[model samples]
Target: MAILVLSVLVLLLSLYFRLKKRQKNDGLNKFPEGPSHPLLGHLPLMTSTTDVIDVSMQLIRNHGKTVKIRIGPKILPMRTSLLTADSHLTEFILSGNKILKKTENYQFLKHWLRKGLLISDGDYWKRHRKILTPAFHLEVLKEFVQVFESVGDVLIEKLRRCEGTPSCDLHPFVTLCTLDVICETAMGTKMNVQSGKNSHYVQSVKKTCRIIIERSMSTLKLTDTTFWLCRDFYTLKNELKVLHDFTHNVINSKKNNKSIDKNTKRLAFLDLLLKFSQDENILSTDEIREEVDTFMFAGHDTTASGICFTLYCLADHPEVQKQALQEQKDLFGDEKNPVITYPDLQNMKYLEQVIKESCRLYPPVPIIGRYTTEDTEFDGCLIPKYTNIMLFIYGLHRDPDYFPEPEKFKPERFDNFDGSLSYTYIPFSAGSRSCIGQKFAMLEMKSIISKIVRHFEIKPTSPRHEVKLSAETVLKSLNGIKVTLKKRP
Candidate 1:
């Protein structure tokens, strides 16, 4: 029976490749090709190695800014994607309305996130985007500054335990803090994840993120039917249940208690959704949960990763850290715990540059994907319709043409920076479909990092820890982001 199953798989693969060969003859091979196996294409090349980013970088180095990467056997609609680091091409894709549909790469999130803004396209995306736009407006995000301060206080207290230690991993501590921040800001419920209260929910989120990335990288687990055969399928099922249940309970609780806090006038993302649902009839309960869950997923991990990378950059570059700390001193005048306000966060121009430079080196979301709905002509090449376009943001940020000495951590490069670079420096992305929470993220990051610098002197480990980059859903280090923290005198 096993032998019969193996034979059937072999026959199917052979037939699939045969059809792929015929389809490729139909003038679809317009882009420059990379090294790939005829049958498996780039799937084996990408999955065979642990460092997917390195493989992608190597491909770009060998094939210039744009390289054709085939990952599967589908050919009529085409499973072959164009991997590009070109800013001009990126602008063409990101700035256009026709290529707004996200590629199948993001489909793994559907089971967890549903049709939230991150995955939804066309009219549904438009409606939800319109409805949710106000939640992250400057005014609404200003309300979140208090949340950032309170949550950042917890992070500082937690990191105090690691103070004076030889070395500590900052990723886990920062991740929990961001999770807590997102829980409070997105759901208006204090999760206290940093205080070690909601272990199950936190673990479920971590597990779900890991499982989704694992499934996305595996060719066999791309489809639901085949995914069921993998062990992670069951794990993902249980984790999603926990995540969905937690979000649903929060939504229900918020619905039951509709009284707004009179003192602070703080409205969470969930609160705004509920208001829209009641006042404007814009969102249903399930839709509310969908957007809430999307915020929870998108909000926490990306910011946490960004913060960790920035901290790592600061640790490695002491002069930059010293200058950043001096800027903090200038802002707060040696007040250990100064009340950080919106204007203060805006005044953190140098710290903002540090964050941008860190993001340039290690963008939380290293790559974004878009699908071409129709045959598109750009740079004299005709890309076939329904082709997946992988925008390699990491490679784009490091391109020498756009950024001279791109590998160095030089924050001052952003000094007096106009918008001359266009799409080349898009750490938060660009265009209409750009990150909605970008301003919130920037403010939160500025608030948290500023408080951290004011309270602690961060330094690199004695051996100099280096992060082994992994191209997960969010960029993570295989080795933890390690640094030593000393309480400022």
Candidate 2:
């Protein structure tokens, strides 16, 4: 009787897999196939590998640009995604208004960022985008240049401590500096993160980011119930409380404070939101917190990643660094620490090229996700509704057709380049849903990078460290971004 029961179970399991395989084949027949398991789909491929980015690149090379990857277990109602590095498909997806909803993976951020611009969709996203658009305008960004210069000064002083060291990991120092910049410019609150005054806030932010990434990757922690049972969930809960409390405190302080003269003080992004809240009454206090928190999250980490990678590239390539330094020297001749005004930042054209090239090689946000809201056709291939789409920005930037000799770091390639095209290089992404703070981010990066190049002669370590790139919430190096610095005389 026991043998008979076991035989029946085996037969049922076999039948289940067979049915699932057939359905998968029928559903994704139009798209190119990627390496996948019979029962687990592509989950095993991603989970088993430590080099996720490299593995993904290889998969794209083996398969076509647009390949269908099945996710989760076959026994359950799993997700099907079209992972595309194809520029045309990327343009089709990103340039369209019909598919603005983010994929389910972004749900992990909702607990922390709430329904801010990064995760919000439809009318809410549109409304918030409109309200926040003016905050990144030329006049507003010009006002923030002084903030960047002050933050850059702090960064230079911090790095000066490590000047004589054989090598130093710049990631931590750069991260803290960007954190300070975002807090001051976005919230009108000085976090003093660089000085270690708000260690709890900094740690909480880092912990929350790690938890979100881990939760997104873990199949076991994907569901709310399962996540609630995990140890990480508890840690994340505590960290989120710390983060939310900080944002709320800032909001409360801003609301009650009335001593500031509006004309003399530069308005922050938070100030703008408050003005909107008071005048139009379109945003609640919680909504204001959400936007502020969103800016804090989006603004800092991504820019830090960009700055670190650019510095690494500069250290690795001496000639490129020399050219960039020469441009800076030409601009601020004989001035050791010239004030980095908006025009000075704008005039550092070669430095801009170097930054752009580094971004091409290592985009901060390597992959961005969107889901189809309706059945869509791309290049004669029909995509069913509710399908997730992973736009491989890393792969798009490396497409040799658009960027010749893609592996080589050639800043000159961008001398006369037009990156405005939706399908081409999009480190900050493109189209209607593109990063609103692109201008602000670029200005900040230019200000910071130019300052570093002007004040220090950056060089690679004696052994030369190779960054092991990891595709996290943002692009990060598993090994630190190591470089040696000699203060310019």
Candidate 3:
């Protein structure tokens, strides 16, 4: 009986695949020309995130508009429709039209993430966005200046401790600093991960990113089964349990106790979330935990990668470094006695432009993936239901058409700029599902950049400090971004 049931299920699945493949026949003519494969769709080379980004670029070069990729049977052909990054198609997708919804494969994230703003769609998305939007108001963000500055001070002190060392990996320090800031401001907890070199929370967060990267790269056909049996998922789950336990205990302690201290005020995200969670049907405990975890992970890592890259770019170009130093001096005086207040940070226009240019060159989230549901027509192509679309943010940013001299780093490009075409610049992504923590991220980046430039004279360590990238889900440097930071007089 068991054998019969297994065989029957496999046969049904095979039939479904055949039918789906047949429907894909007529769609290719309307879409951009992709490789012709016998059985597998154009997914043969697109197994990794890096490959996915590469293929998308290739399609843009070859097909010019929309590219249709067919996933083979083994791969389950997830996200077969790679959308064209043109003005019209991009605008169509980004506008909150009722016809299109967030692809269904985002459900994989839902298992761990729950219905947070990043993954939720439709009315659920709308309501949650409304409630969460107010939480990130401008005044509230401006208040976070102290928390950001405090973290910056600690980071400067840490770098001072390592002054005599030949060089240090700036990535880890930036990551730890941002982590400290997010934990204190977002959740009102004192993680102090930056203090201890080997904090469990820090390790757990790193491990979680690794797990997600692994899962994303897994063969799509086996993803459902593999996730069910995977040890990584279990490990991530356990880590989240630890985080939840920590969060709940903090919340419980703060619930009835009204003695507000300086420390309590410093706990930003947690306090806001806790206060909001008390409202009727506002958010579930599970939901609140997911948001906190999401912010903890997403909030810290993206900003860290951006800052790391900015430092690297400065090291690579000494002239730009000199200009930045001059700006720093002009803004806050000499390095020996530098102080960056909130208003000063706001006025550092040149520094802001540099950060933008760095992020443009090396976006933290280089590629974003979405799955299409139901047959759809985009850019004159018929996209079948359940097709996976890979949006190549890195490729789009580097396209010479949109950004002239795409390879060169020029902060001045944005100095006199009006906004470009929506599809042209997607460092933060677009649409209803764009990054919610963008403001927070900007504040964090500005503070870190101001502090680092003000205190240190950055120089390349080795003659060849190669900017190689490791493809964990996030583009991180495997060797670490090593640079020498000389203290300024």
- The TM-scores, one per candidate, come to 0.93, 0.94, 0.87
lDDT of 2: 0.88
Highest-scoring model, TM-score = 2
Each prediction's RMSD to truth: 4.0, 3.0, 4.0
Q: For model 1, where is the 10-residue window of minimal lDDT? A: 71-80
Q: All models: lDDT?
A: 0.88, 0.88, 0.73
Which of the two, 1 or 3, has more lDDT?
Answer: 1
Error of 1 at 296 (Å): 0.3
Residue-level lDDT tens digits of model 1 in 143-163? 889999999999999999998
Q: In candidate 2, residue 26 scores what lDDT?
A: 50
**Cα deviation of 266, candidate 3, in Å:** 6.4
**Which portions of model 3 miss their true places by more than 4 Å?**
1-29, 36-44, 47-50, 73-79, 99-108, 161-166, 220-222, 260-267, 279-281, 335-339
Q: For candidate 2, write residues 346-434 as lDDT tens digits.
A: 88889889999999999999999998888877777678888898999998889887888999999998887865554788898878899
Candidate 2 clashing pairs?
none
lDDT of model 2 at position 363:
98
TM-score-sorted candidate list, best first: 2, 1, 3
